[model samples]
Target chain A: MSRHARDDNVPLNADATSSRDLALEVENLRTVFHTEHEQIHAVDGISFNIRRGETVGLVGESGSGKSVTARSILGLIESPGEIDPASAIRFEGDNITEYTESEYESIRGDGIAMVFQDPLSTLNPVYTVGNQIKEALSLHQDLRGTAATERAIELLEEVGIPDAARRVTEYPHQFSGGMRQRAVIAMALACAPEVLICDEPTTALDVTIQAQIIDLLMDIQAERDLSILFITHDMGVIAEVADRVNVMYAGEIVESAPVEPLFAEPKHPYTRGLLRSIPSTQTSGDRLETIKGEVPTPNEPASSCRFAPRCPKSFEECSEVAPIPTAVGDDPDHDAACLLYPESMTTDEAVAHHRPADDGGEQ
Target chain B: MGRWEYFLKRVLLMVPIVFLGTTVTFLILRVGPIDPAAAIIGPSGDTEAYAAIRDSLGLDQPLWIQYAEFMRDLLTLQLGESWVVVRGQSVWELVGVYGPRTLWLGFWSILIPIFVGLPLGFYAGLNPNTLADYIASFGGIVWRAMPNFWLAVIFVSVLTQSDALFGFSWGDWLVETQIVTPPDLSGLWEPTQFLGALKAILPAALVLGSASMGNEMRIGRTAVLETKNANYVEMAKAKGVPGRLVVWKHMFRNALIPLVPVITGEAFLLLGGSVLVETVFAINGLGYLFFQATINGDVPLVGSLMFLFILLSVGINILQDFLYTVIDPRVGYDGGA
Candidate 1:
């Protein structure tokens, strides 16, 4: 029933030897948020897996539901916001959604944990830093008095907070933004959860700080053999850390493949556009080539494929019906949701003897 | 010169604002159309007797001359005498008799609310969307919407009925028909007791405290909620901090900083309205004196009492501004500019 418990009989490193083993399996997980006005399909049947000791980057533009998908995996979605019954988020062999209230108590922090964005507002202003960290340790593990205090200071030091002994007694407001984020990360790692979910942990920091955080996370992941569900919109961060990349658009995964292949061959028009959008030092100008149209709001459901309106290769069928994920050129793990693929195409395209306008037609 | 100059500028500005407010209150009282001279001498009294009373009270003078004399007397603090009492006494002397009751009531009422409301509000905020939060918010809303007078009436009725049910004596604490004159109190401790005297004050506190409690709890709950959403709270949570520490240590302090001014302002407002509470309870507080002077058409006394109220509110505002600077450090001490 536990997500992280090892099975002695089963062979480890079930997949590629370099990748440890499967840590979390999210199969067709759909999260629907019921707002006052309408039903928002925040995560539309998204599926992915994070291997042990490996980072899987859920990369997409903001509002593509990357953060919502990460939160849903941890059962952190606020109620009245409906999460679909069809979704199965299995950590190890145990299904997370099936866990009763009491069972979830053990799992929420110890089994899996999350580090949120915005370091500035992450800590409560009134509490001493030492008391806060000490409380976290006590919540997931049993430590009291001097033991808790000592552990709290050690955690602070682990997160690169300077003067750990004295700073532990300081307040959140007294810490810099980078230090606050580190403190937050320290809290998430308190119980050494099997899987750690980080949502744009570096997006709020300066570039140097961002690099430092990325390095720290990577170092910690290696040290603990922790599976990380790294959620970010930055392609650069994905290239730096992720072994597998899932490109999401309009609350659905448009493409998922090994990091190398996904970036090299891309396949989906949306994925290609995202790659192009990544700004490099060479691509310097005020005009960064964006993935044209904005991501659709959840309030308004898309007509066909959620990304079709924004896709340069959009066709008649793209407007009328949604495209389901299909294999992109016989690769099992690599899937693309697009009308251009023959298996998932509209009748209008077949009659026209049409291929997806193959060339990047001058726009 | 610079500091004094700034202080003088503010004081000068306060003059017109306070004067205009007092004049409006005075005119409204005068325009009620129940002639003071007629009321004073009575319908059965001879015309000459009424004329003589009018002359002595200066009611026979022209409106401009009367207004001028009233303003002049107000500045000098010579509030003059109350006209409603059988043997009319000085307004200050009347206030001296009843002022402590109102002050005592206001103090207790404000204190009880702070003691009870804040902790309830803090707990409710910490447990957001839970039954506790719902109960606190709903209960607060109901109490806040209830008029203080209505609450007072309800409490009195309940206490009376409960006493009847038990065949026990429920004291007539709210409406004390017998009035006691103020005693001389030069002793330091005597001042404290005089300030905290129960007879005039208890009912006042009950009325004001209950109302302020409901409002303060709601404010406290909101401040806590806003603080709970801060990044530091999540940081604490990430550290595996227990729920109590997260709430009390991190969220509670920042949340409380913003509430200091609001609590202070409400305290002063309660003090200002203690007069009304005292009147309802039948206590001869300053409110009773103010009421008597107005009823008897003692314009000078009314004007002076109004000045005291204005002074109290302004003083509280200045204190609140200074306290706000000390508590949050974001606000400037100089009038929060």
Candidate 2:
């Protein structure tokens, strides 16, 4: 991974660098699925941004709208599932929330690409891996025939597939789970997308293979300066690749901070519970801690903080009032939605309270 | 097993199926109350003539011996001469005279549905719950519900009769233009005669095709609908492939994998439907011959035709199995014992 990182210093494309440093800005995005019985709020007013060359992680349990947010950003959600009119997904500076199907097609592979979970299912079994990559290149780059084939082979080699020239002709089932994931990543990177959204890209891989994939992604990001929105439920994975992390619960982001500070000083009760549940070397053979209750169903109307029912630090007001974003500690960038932080707590007061200072020492 | 090896195994498997079908058909026809000697001798009150005819025809032999003789004749491909129906003509000769017409009718029946119903079904699947979907669904149901014989009768009376209820006839125009010459038994094998016969049978083909088309369309629609939701299809869309390519190249190909058996099964289905169709149109086809042979107790002709039908069905099914490996790469025959 380190060896490949130093050799490729050439910029991916002029358009990728010419755009503003902000790769994506999703503001108040809401996605809802209207079924016969009820409307499911899959993503509820979530806001985040991915800066150019930065990897931002979105972490949440299953059904917490992490995947939904990624799909909504790409405009991949279809009928019965809709992005609300008020939602705004600005890619590079253009608001694309209302883009038509044809308009989305032009921007999808070229401007932004996605790598999904279950690589075997994600790839068409009937097609060769190389052919699938060539298709992506032809669609977005207009590189056809041998030119496309050569580029496809290059991508396969770059993704660490050995004997790529021969393997390109083999179908998806001919490849192992890890190799198929690598092929999927190669296809995602075929058009040199400005922003790559990886939705649990390594979830289906073995632990060792998961580390390899993450290392590959990191090396690729360093060489190409690609912005990635990495979505995963595993905090350990998020710690590996994410510069910044957003913790989501019940279709909303409850905490946002830099990786080190977030892990060192988790301010939200739910975030604290998640951190405590992670097994540590010090706590070997000890019973792991767990949050008291399940994540609430998204269809239910929330009168107050969605996590209040499961939070151990809940007070009388926790159930009555919704918590807004409040700065935690001296770092104004670190914010958590909880009632503990007073409205008027400046940097001096936050330091005086020094709750994270105590937690930081133990880490 | 390799592809060729698997194919060979499938081919070998058909031998037993055809053999069993022949055995069952022979036994059923022989053991049934319909006696060929009685039918040939008639009700003339001549017991001696009946006995003599029965003995000469080998009907006097025990059941096992007669079965052995039938099997031997079948192995030698010498189907005996038809008795009591089309008497004196060998069963093979009768099949040679009528087989092509039925095949021609069945081909058109299957082809029309593939060209028309498949696309309609695909379009319907693409736009589920829309007005077009509802229309296709309703139309398919109506066509399938109408019996082929009734449809054939209605078409002949309305389209072929000179003084038809509609007061105009496509059949008359077809006849007058020489596009549909009356069935000429002698020139039936000639290309010109074949085309003329096809034109004459177009109305019957339309009726037969429409009935089967409903089933084809429904199967195709269901397959497409299920395939559209497959993970690979979603992945293709996410890869930024254009919607048209996604639907046609990815979704349609995957959908067609499940439709292979249905497509092959239609061959036998169309053959079955041809019986009523040939009778209504007065075409000299295998189905019509089988019907006449059954009515006249022509055991040899009937049994041979039944065996042919079984062979064709088993052959088609083997072909369908081979196509399965072709369409879906994940399914392989190499690992099987």
Q: Which predicted model would earn the best lDDT?
A: 2
Worst 10 residues of 1 chain A by lDDT: A1-10
What residue pairs clash in candidate 2, if any at all?
none
> lDDT of model 2 at residue B209?
85
Q: After superposition, how far is residue B223 of candidate 2 from its true place, in Å?
A: 1.6
Candidate 1 residue lDDT tens string, B167-258: 65344434332222322233427645443345434544666777677878888988988876665665455444455655666677688787
Q: What share of the true interface contacts does candidate 2 keep?
A: 0.65
- Top candidate (TM-score): 2
Candidate 1's fnat? Answer: 0.39
* DockQ for each model: 0.23, 0.49
Q: How much is the lDDT of residue B282 in candidate 1?
A: 64
Give lDDT tens digits, candidate 2, residues B1-337: 4446666777788888888888989889999878988888766749888889989989989999999999888867777788867779888888888887777778788888888788888889999999999999899888889998898888766665554565765655534322222254357678766656667667667788886688878988998999888878877888789999998889888889878877787777545777887887777688888898888887888887787788788878888978976787656434321
Per-residue lDDT of model 2, residues A73-178, tens digit only: 8888989999988777888677899899888888888799999988879998778788899999988888999999899999999999999999888888788899
Q: Provide TM-scores for the models.
A: 0.69, 0.87
